[model samples]
Target: MVARRRHRLIQRRKMLGFSQEQLAHQIGVERSTVVRWESGEREPRPWQRPRLADVLEVSLEEVDELLAAQVNEEPEAERLDFAMRNPAAVDLVTVAHLAQRVQQLNAQYDAAPSASLLADAGHCHSQVTLLRGFAPNGRIRRELCVSTAESAILMGQLVWDASQRRDHAVSVQYFDQAISAAREIRDPILEAHAQLRKGFVALYGTKTPKEGLRLCNETAIVGRAGSNVLSGLGFLHVGEAYAMLGERHDCERALGAAEESFARIHNDDEALHMFSPTQFDRLAGSCYLFLGVNDKAEQILTRSARSLVRWKKSQSIVLSNLTLAYIRQGKLEEACGTLHEAIDLIAETRGGGGLNTAFTAGREMSPWRHEPWVQEISDRLFALMTT
Candidate 1:
């Protein structure tokens, strides 16, 4: 196979008048390491990224794009053509492969642009749908449908994120399709997961806390039969909705119930896609932020933000909330610093939740627009808009 050239990296390096050895020397790496990276034989480490970005005079997000382009030059369809061509081969093993592919794309959701993965995810979803129709056994067919529902939900999320959460109608339609697919397979867990995502649309996209609360309650009911983790997550969203509505008593009660459910969660729970351990504190921090408890929000978010470093998209949301908490407390410098972190994560992930939170943080900073730090942050936000 011919080696794939990192054209963007090469162009940037040459534009900056640097040879491979000089560039590597500047970043304290071996010239062979630079050669390997440019030849697509190696990738830059996370710790080395900032310096690489500085040397290339490119944003970290741009570096990510360049790397992804190099690594995935071949379309996903080409890689999975065998499965698509021989739908009759749609057994448990094939299903496992499809599910693994979906998981791989899902893992990139927090680190890569949504548009980058949307095509492959859509193709994978379509293949799964086709395979289910050709599946010889009821068990295989049902499993395929489960995977289809997951793919549909992931497509909805990617579309929403790619559109910056502005295309609510399309996202909702995908969720509805996923819900129907799940119902057809009689998988309450999958159906509940779809409903939970719909709640997110209602809460964040439509700005309807009451509707979000109702959907979240429904999710909790179905999730109870499926997964303790998902049920707890549903109640956590319910608490968030209550907080949005300024129902302090109800919010606290729902949060307590969520905590109880979380404590009962075990490793055997399904709905792995919809649940995470960091979720409780993340949502709790957002709830406190909504309820005007800045101190409490800051406390929870600061701690949770550290733990969420592995998930840049989630960490961005936490950082956004922490920025808001700081802003509310008149900690302008700290708020500005956190806002920058959130914006940087947004540039990398382009996730809807983080983007919306970053913008919200910007709007909240308007009162202090005269401050140099606030103005500098505003400039950063402006650059994001133009880009």
Candidate 2:
């Protein structure tokens, strides 16, 4: 007489990298409707079942089977626990459960604070690592390695951001784990992604543009074997590193190459989901900022910020850089307004690069530092960082 959950259905959705909200949007239903369906309180209407199945990448009969299969409150959790206790018995379904959990955590990552996500991400990574050690030499082991690579990348990002980018060594260690896993699997896309993440620490945290540039070139080449998205993104950072080094011609060339790489992306590109329309603009704006072209930076950053509203971390950095552009143009009041907006987003996201950028913009407001508005904003940023 008790309501049950649809474990298989939920796992399928997460395994395919779709959050309940995303799945609902795809199926033209409210998120609560998807929630109810997963909770076994209500079934999808006949008209919606086909769309639901399509979103879930399941056949019509499989969709019905998933819906009719009543489940325990936390079947995935139970299976994972048992697998953890008896790792040698780990199978593909167990690997799917682990991968789905990691993906669910990743789904929540963008909007949430890194500190809030670190613990769960670390737990998932540890499980993946342990299972990898015990998994037999077969498809199950290979799948476990893939999950390890994914969870390692997530852990690296979480650790770096949670520490506000100060803890470089620990973050790099996790990224290395991912890179090693990718090499074992011979997966270029994953290898390039982990390498790019490691280079971010060098470029921003350590202030090493040359080292960052080296990493960018390496990843761009490695990415060529599989993913246009990673390659394009790598070139974008390559441009940023060139900008940091005051190499204008190389920066522009990198931008052009990035555009061409992006132009080649198809709907079925291996890493298409990572591609963002605003990425080029955001990095282009950074290039302009670095080159002391304040007007161009402001124009590009303003346009980029508009499309980046949904991504709090990236949008916050864009707003922070836009604040710098305003400051450089001697627009004190406008700079202060944009700084406040950036600070608000940073307070919500605790984005490491954005946090560092907001403070840098605040410090560069020295000409107007005597103003009460600037002083108040500085105080707010300090409070946000401490919290």
Candidate 3:
């Protein structure tokens, strides 16, 4: 229990944007102690609790409540319920929090025996619709909206999981419901996002990129001119569609348009949560990599790597692209290292599989499947895809 409190303290500290060393200095503890707390390997002494709470800028009572609520939550269902009720309280929580919340929701939905869970899922879906609508304004709004959107997204994601598990009819019904909710919210960006996701369902799982591209193109049309960030994302889908179609020139043109749109929106500081330099670079890098322009891909991807590392999110996608770039350069050892790092990072976040980022990487790497080192990585990655 004490160890759990310490872990929660570390989570709070991180959400507040404090580094381990910075937090340690503030609380007059060694950095090692902070690390231990984060790792759940040790606990702060009872006397240190107040100071820890103070340093985290959360009230001691609030900290105590959080620790008590979360420490004993072993099943995913309980965690999702807590997140739904305490959405506002979790704004400063880390990616880990979001992942855990999503996981619990998925688990509950899978094992559901009552209509209440379905209703709860619907409510969560509504919240996501609301939040995705709010994402274009700024960071504060994005942060505020994410908890709600996350809840909804998780429900939709569980539907997808069910589809994967052969509950096909149920999954299709759930997606339809989710899409309707998104439409009612009247958020073009999220509508576009939903369509993009549906496109993936068509392309990869259903083996119909043409149908997927049709949906993705609709998303781009709706998303364009809404937010520069969203516009770029829309273009990304267009580019992806072109790539899948084997239209290299069309892919390049769409990718170039994405980069141009992104450049116009680029800023020194994040302009809302909608647009970030890192995300733009990453998308550009991915497009170029797929186009087989290794030099251009490497340049853009390197920038993305640096930016994503600073943000501490999307590292898995970034690393996956970096591995592809290294493989292109015939840097076998570097590629292997990056692939391992990507796998580890993805395992840690455990949220992005729904995006099919890993599978996309595997598909992109198919060209190198015959290369010895690439084959080694491909074998491992393909196994993951199958299971």
Candidate 4:
């Protein structure tokens, strides 16, 4: 069953001005088939997806995302039903459902509002926590605890994001719980994720570079124990913390280590979800921006921006940083244009990271506040706040 609710297909259909019947006819399928596909009851056959993609004017990759969106919108009722029907058989099926649901929710993190998703995510976390308490002995219980760790980490993320990166204490509490749970299973990857998340709270939310750096180093150590790819990803954050500290030499070395790790990464690595193809460049761009090398930052961020379209919140952050790079370089018109684009994305997603970046960029433009375009941007931001 679908475990997340995303409306990519529905939005695409409306954008193309096609009704279910019309799309079905164009794709040579029954109207019911279109309804089923859109409603998450069924997926199109492999052979049929190409035609569907063509009709929807989406690429094969985008078609996959759209289909995944439809398939993951599973209802809470179904999970409760499973729990009720086979309290005795809840070992495998229930664990599988919860794992998939948590993963799906995490996948939507970049595009969905944390506030909109918090209740459902919290409910899932509670279910996992309850199951952990009464779960049967041995392997099943261990697996359930692992899932619980993941769910707890996700909860911490959602809570922090929903609070606009405030509520650091509560968020860190969840992360600590997640870390303890992972340690129970001796799962370094899970523990590393928790540490990295806690590092985020330190760096962004609390503005504690020392604590963030310490957590980042610890995360890298744990990741190195299990997977080189994950280690490299952790080092990227280490580099970020160093940049924030204005430690140029240390930042460069950390970034180089991250590159080496990236080079060693294979397709079979665990915790690959934490690594993004755009990660190094994106972080590198930010590092340069922090170091006041606006030209280099612009070069990197502009390139990464083009490749980050699918991740709306990530793209918004890149665009905001790119705007800052332009503003620092006195490229006033370019900065104004890019800020508008970032604002558009922030309006749609309300992503905390993006929202934070937007405001930071605006604050940096205070010297230009009297410019007509700058005034216009300020008005837009005010509207965004009131809205």
Candidate 1 residue-wise lDDT, 206-289, digit = tens: 999999999999999999987887789889999999999999899999999999998997856766545677888999999999
Sort by TM-score, best first: what order?
Answer: 2, 4, 1, 3
- Models sorted by lDDT, best on top: 2, 1, 4, 3
Expressed as tens digits, the lDDT of each residue in 55-118 for candidate 2 is 7766899898778855444466787888999999886557879988787887787799999998
Lowest lDDT 10-mer window, candidate 3? 109-118
**Runs of candidate 1 exceeding 4 Å displacement:** 1-93, 134-137, 272-274
Cα lDDT of candidate 4 equals 0.83
lDDT by residue for model 3 over 171-202, one digit each (tens)? 44555554554465555555555556666566
Give me the displacement of residue 91 in model 3, in angstroms.
23
Where does candidate 1 clash, by residue pair? none
Candidate number with the higher TM-score (2 or 3): 2
Error of model 4, residue 337, in angstroms: 0.8
Winning model by lDDT: 2
The lDDT of each candidate is 0.84, 0.88, 0.59, 0.83
Q: After superposition, how far is residue 88 of candidate 3 from its true place, in Å?
A: 24
Candidate 2 residue pairs that clash:
none
Model 4 is weakest, by summed lDDT over 10 consecutive residues, at 1-10
**lDDT, candidate 2, residue 344?**
90
